[model samples]
Target: MMFKSQRFFKSLQLLIVASLLILPLLISEEGLNSIISTKAVFKYSIFCFIFLSIHFLHRYLLFPKLYARRKTILYFTSLLFILAALIFTRPFDRLMFELRPKPNQVDAPRREPPHSTENRPPMGNERRSGPKIDVLSVFLFLIIITIEVIIETNKQLSLTTQRAISAEAQKTEAELSFLKAQVNPHFLFNTLNNIYTLAIIKDENTAPSIMKLSNIMRYITDEAGNEFVSLRNEVDCIEDFIALHKLRLGKKTTLNYEVKGFLDAEKKIAPLILMAFVENVFKYGISNHSSNKLIIKLAIEDNILNLLCQNSIYPDKKDTERSGIGLTNTKKRLDYIYPNKHILEINDDDKLFTVKLTIHL
Candidate 1:
């Protein structure tokens, strides 16, 4: 926008320069005496202004592409030089010089003057009988035009660059928002898996777990994208995740889970945020289940959620892969979305794996 304004001012400035320069040359007595009468000079100035204005306007407005290239500048400048030279030589110069009074000797029958053999003055006219081509003025005019063209080109380029930058910023923001949305769908997929497992085992806890999952999903669908949610709502989501995990395990496992303090269920997190530890336990603990014993503890103090869970190691003596999607994705989201506001600790021994998560709401 600034460039556009500059271009407009420059164009208007050049037009005013042209008008001011040519105007007095038509109206002044000295200018009229040197060439044609005032009326003819006025006509000439008007013709020159109209013609030049049309030429420039056509190139700049109607056919910008035509004047945008360097070759066009060279072509127009050369054409203008030729036009100026022709204006000097045309018969209009002879008629204007005839405005001067006849010589005093013309009363002696105005005899046909003999052609001079040397560089002598003509019979009646002075040394300069016609229009003069001032090369300096023509050259200066061309230079001014060239500068104006360059300025206009720069203004256009600036406008184009600004638009490109704005578009790129919008695209980057859209991509980041999309990646954030992907995390919610990931949670839903895991919940669906837990529900399917529960049906297979015919667990009595399935209905309640399903209801909790639905509520957590509602939080995700409606509110997770906002700036903040209460710490209480986040704890509710964690409880729901634990409930579903417990339902899938059924009577085959013994689980201890606890929460202290008045946990408000309105706290918000990045929706579906708490499944990381719950999923990790089921994958490496209950799935192996040498004894099927697990302990899950949660507490809230001073607006913080502290989660602790431990379970027996996999029975097949296999080391659980830390690179699995559930843990790795959770780790990334935690660092990206929670950053210094959250803490996570993992400990594993020959018999058990333990995880502790502390979140500053």
Candidate 2:
């Protein structure tokens, strides 16, 4: 019902504009006085729209070779029709224009002066007729039409470009949000695993673990839901994530993590953007066991975030094709969301497994 109402209003607006356009060619000052008396500025508006719409329709639809011949033929036909209309309608329009509310005694030159056969050679001379045109009026009419067509076409083109740009912006925004949502679950699964591990251990630090989990969940729910969020919020979420995972890993496993320069308050980044590399650290870094095994470095400098995660990989045990959905989804999301903004490289061999993600926000 709402849609139909809107459509009806749109149709009504079109009708009003069209009516105003042709109104100048229709009613006269006397006739207008009979209908309604006011100083309403009824300018030539419809003729302008008709004139431009025809030109554009010609350029796009008719100018092509397939239709050019047909259009040329149709155009000649239309010119004939307009010529006939001018011949046929001019007298009527002039008659209406000349008509007064009160009666007049005499007519001017337009009142049809006597066909003076008596003045010169009466019966011997032939009647001479002028061309079927008013040169000055026709020239003015054409000039007005051309000027109006150009102005209206420019206005319409500007409106069309603005609408196209607005639509593209909306589509980009929707796709980016969907890309962000796709990575949220991977983070959730990891946090849930932490809670499960803490439960099995029955650790005293479980309360703090729950708090970290809450912060992570809240960050995902609240911050990711928005169109944009502060860079600080994203960094804090990453901090809480590493802290929670560190609790699970314990002091026995070697861990080295670094933080670089500050993230500006004005800077903003997509949510769940860096989850893939961090997730790989936990999934693959678990059984490294060597005294100098685990090493993960993340540093942000000059608006660039460079991270390197290195863990040990046993040749026989670990899958060289460590292809999984979480990592694949991360790669795809990075492409769609960041494009030229980031580079990710993963290198793995017998002794060391390394993944590096670099992004310039």
Candidate 3:
């Protein structure tokens, strides 16, 4: 229904413009007499038909096919061809309507003016007294056609911009969906592993780890689906994850987790964005005989969220493949969500691996 209404209005607008153009000619003194005479009416109808046909041809066909395509030679050649055809055929068309009534048979010979040859201008310089060609109407047709071309060009540009925006939106949605899908399974696996180790050792903290896991699962299922979540909520989830991992740590492990500066409730971040780095520490930093050190710090200063994670790696205990959506998906998510608003840097050495991330709130 909406489409039909729009098309109807467009047709009505075209009709109104056509009426405004041709009605003035019909209401003129010469035009009123032409309408009363059968021969003159036929000639006037032909002129109007040619005028409208040329106007539309230039606007719809010639401009788009030649001018818009940057075929400069072809465009000007076609324009000249059409104009020359119209100019040359006009005389033949006028001759067909030159049927004035003849005078009676008793006429005398005509005489020239008494002015001398010197007084009169030379034949080459003398201007013809007959009606000059009417080019104003042709110029008006060209102007209207050019205006139509400009309007169409602007409309196309606007449509292109809208399509670009829509495409970017769709890409962002797809990326977020993939990240969420990975987040759920990757998080659940690591949490379950920590609980499994506790159950094997028959530790008293096994039940507490399960409880923390339940709370973490609830938060992930609820908030990880969102595009952004409060910074406080993210910090709470990260703390819960750290507590669960601590159950499996031995006395040789030095795990220092700290959060400094104000964590404004209104400040939001992509869900589970900071958890990946912390998870990697528990996955690869622990060793059976070696002392391990892990440091995680998060600070908010002047609307900037700064994160630093550093962990010592035992040469014998380092896993060749640090599985689960560790850094790859994290980096991809950062690019999609934060883009130019975040900075990420990683420095790895023989003994330790460090990650620093800064985000603009």
Candidate with maximal TM-score? 3
- Which residue pairs collide, candidate 3? none
- Judge candidate 1 at residue 287 and give its lDDT: 54
Over the stretch 247-297, how does candidate 1's per-residue lDDT look in tens digits?
Answer: 456577888878787767665565445655765666666653345778877
| lDDT per model vs. reference | 0.61, 0.59, 0.71
Q: Candidate 2 — worst ten consecutive residues by lDDT sum?
A: 37-46
Model 2 scores a C-alpha lDDT of 0.59
TM-score, one value per model: 0.41, 0.44, 0.51
Error of 3 at 75 (Å): 26
* Deviation in Å, model 1, residue 162 alpha carbon: 19
Give me the displacement of residue 204 in model 2, in angstroms.
5.2
For candidate 1, the 10 contiguous residues with the lowest summed lDDT are 91-100
Ten residues in sequence with the least summed lDDT for candidate 3:
95-104
- Which of candidates 1 and 2 is the stronger one according to lDDT? 1
Query: Candidate 2: where are CA atoms >4 Å away?
Result: 1-204, 225-228, 250-252, 288-292, 315-317, 320-325
Clashing pairs in 1: 229-268, 230-267, 230-268, 231-267, 232-264, 232-267, 233-266, 233-267, 234-267
